[model samples]
Target: MLSLFSLAHAMEMAAASSIRTSPRASFLTSSTLKCGPNFISKTSIPANLMEKGHKRASLFSIRSQQSEPKDGSVILPPTSDSEANAVTIKDWEIGRMQDEIVSSQGIRIRRRPPTGPPLHYVGPFEFRLQNEGNTPRNILEEIVWHKHTEVSKLKERRPLIALKRALENAPPVRDFIGALKASHLRTGVPALIAEVKKASPSRGVLREDFDPVQIAQAYEKGGAACLSVLTDEKYFQGSFENLEAIRNAGVKCPLLCKEFIIEAWQIYYARAKGADAILLIAAILPDLDIKYMSKICKMLGLTTLVEVHNEEEMDRVLGIDGIQLIGINNRDLESFKVDISNTKKLLDSEHRQAIHDRDIIVVGESGLFTPDDISYVQEAGVKAVLVGESIVKQSDPTKGIAGLFGKDISV
Candidate 1:
């Protein structure tokens, strides 16, 4: 067994090997979150994807770096921030980048990615969301904006470096895509990624008596190939403790940490908490952030469920690499308007061909409440379905799975 110190060293060595960037890069020319190129220190780095040992790649290179660039080399650091600066800059920069990401993709929406570090804070680390035009507009947006504060607090309590060490003791990740594919081949139906959801903004308190472990066990017994646990505490009433408990309880189904991830630090945090996969909403994250974050997720050995609500987002995602699973959310995140046909609308033949060509497994998410709903998405080319309200609200979630498909899916 490795000690914590040994594990952190191993993670650094592995990170150095995995985090190579491109050399042919110039610094940013656009107006970005420039609070204190100013504030961030080495310790402020959520996870040192850019830093190899004591040295770090240039902020420029780290910002635009890709998983597999034609010219892969970490940029030379122009300068490092002071301890005060690092804290100030990161606090200012947290949730703002998501909006910037959306704009970079050439898609215009009322909502934007986090534009910069956390600027709306009381102290150095205690932060809040300002009513910037970049601020959140809808319930989902408000939840995301609030998450900026919540996650910053979480990260402040447990820094990225600490999470890296904890990962050494985490459960070995199951093959998330492999499980879905195997279940699909066996069931002749969409593989179930049964949702361990507690509450939603649209529907308050999915189950009055919510037991995450109990629901996860029921899903496993009901033949779910994978499970998704809502880990956000404010809106969803979920906690990472729930994820840890489900893992400790020893259910074999791989777990997806269903959090609104706005920063790379959340990826490492998820792995440390025993999550095998994490959600990356395309609606929320821009293309570059997705590319950068997805690369980080790969380095950490966490699978990404890149969620998209429409075609433009789908095209942007297909343009990225190392993405194996794409989730087509039937609900419009901005409007909270759900239409099951959104799956078919986005996964048209051209998109399906591109997805098939690259061997991407498409997942139909939300508004899937029936066998017909399941079949519709299956015919539309989804290999899996992420169902939450339909099953979790049922008295017996295990039987709910069978009723969902109009037959028993468990072998």
Candidate 2:
């Protein structure tokens, strides 16, 4: 008598052969194929496929006994009802199963190559929607969707184990959160956490000479409380190498790894790559994720700079339990529009009082240049400012920083 495991293994073999033979056969045999390690039969057979004629015959006889024939001559089993219900080749479940099999076997399946519409030169870059019906609801939704997709792809490519290993051995940088709190208490002035960014999707390339370590040193010399480094490779043209280099360059300022914070894995990865703090954009993340990630950052001895662009975002950041530094980004992330008035708009009298009561360090970000711009945001209730382009573009970025502050910040 055939053991249950042997019977299941035979069934799986039959199913595999049936799938290879015809789409019809695949549907007929799929129901019998069991999926588990214990399902593999311990039955012995000739090692070679060419020498297994008798074994094949015995398997066929067993299948024939299990499935009744329909006609005078022995008939093959009926295809599955689901297979019959399929309207077209594209809709066939058996075809999908075949694709999955091919994928599992590590085979590259390719469709027929497109024959030609002669490629014509387009004068300018054009935005064409691939699926018009599947439009995002708004700019915020669009960015969130993009972030989700990007993060999913990253997870597949870099598993969590690898990220943890990277984090465990990563170089350490200065802590932005600690620096901010210390500056606020000591000087009664918010810590100057300036960002070093090159290009943004919304606003092309902001700075011409983009050297991460050099920029970091300049910020340190200019009396910046911390340094924000863009570490996104695709959009920002940044890398972990930049963060590592900045830390190794002997710059004393705490470094914030400016990235789209989607997963806790990324936080660990940042810590491993010498990041002292991270920017958690309130626009994309829900409050729960923010709070959870903030706690994780604290546990890792890292700081979290919760960034907000509007009143709703600000309120959300405030509601989170452990946020110490609040960065008010003047540049609208979705529309790529920059307005200095955004700092003033969000930091109203009521909000200011609430922030002061909590002793939160508010850092004004983007569109800052010259002494007037710096003074404008400072007077409007921002204790510190994040300026990138105007300062970085100057012959000596350190001088540009003094020019913006209008006094020797180094002194």
Candidate 3:
């Protein structure tokens, strides 16, 4: 059986590009395909096409080679045992090939499992597979895989062309970076990007009575320069509705749509929902994707806050051009571990010098609690901080900010 991960990957790729089938291969028509949570399509493939030597030029470059009869129904030839096995083997190859490209860029997380270990036959007996490719290796990988399915379905409903039309009524863009800069100089402290998050996979529910707009207003009143709204509904328990609601609520602080962004389509979606800035995590995105997505944000008048967790990710972001804002996250997305030193470690003398030369603003993210924590990252060269949990959970989040920075920052 082809795993859901494989199906999602194949369908997403097919939907993304025009189908071009080779004349020699067997073709599955759209009638044979069904769409639903429980629906699965039983399609046939020729054994020869699954051979090792056959390959595509790129990850998205998929080629189909089957022809359909005039009646729209084609007879599938009976498959031998070896041929039946070849089907899954080919699926495994495609996933492995795509993963190899990501791993080559120093990324530890695999986009998807290289489709579990191939079936092993030992003297006419098959060994049971212990671990499967459908299982995610870490929290971050799991989130990315889930996002793949979520985005695919969302794109289907609101296609890119439709989303473009909605942009006509999207609220005007705000100066996200300017707000942070002004707050930093005004307060002589790290400008706050207070996160309006309700829950997390690691931290569970942080606020039982979560009012996104109320928290946003409190943060702004407490002197936050920008607001980071968690827009992921599955794991974060946040939604784009909250983003739209907050923006429509008349909050003056610029909004950052904090999402696990994997596609350029998401950029347009965020802008259409009233986001003034968007986050791009260097850990999940490769260099090419970061560059491409950053350009898209620029065109949409949205600031890109490229986040880095380690020195390697920091170095990769530094190599990219036209990046004005960089966020150093102290938490490890994979392990869900928090360490304040991660901020200080990545912004070393060498990287700090490069950032200074390029005029990139570093924002310290996560694992921040007190005045000492803010001061530590400030000393490490972060001009701003993206903080959550500590403030949002307090009875009065406005007073919480005063405790965080050791004084009232409200002007």
* Candidate that would win on lDDT: 3
Model 1's lDDT to the true fold? 0.73
lDDT values, one for every candidate = 0.73, 0.62, 0.78
Per-residue CA lDDT of candidate 2, range 41-125, in tens? 1111111321322222111112223443332333223243332212212222223443353344332221111111111112321
TM-score of each: 0.73, 0.64, 0.80
At residue 187, candidate 3 shows an lDDT of 93
CA deviation > 4 Å runs, candidate 2: 1-149, 181-190
TM-score of 2: 0.64
lDDT of candidate 3 over 306-399, digit per residue (tens): 9999988888888888999999988998998999999889988999999999999999999999999999999999999999999999999999
Query: What shift in Å separates residue 359 of candidate 3 from its native position after superposition?
Result: 0.4
Ranking by lDDT: 3, 1, 2
Q: Residue-wise lDDT of candidate 1 within 11-41, one digit each (tens)?
A: 5454334323312222222211212223222
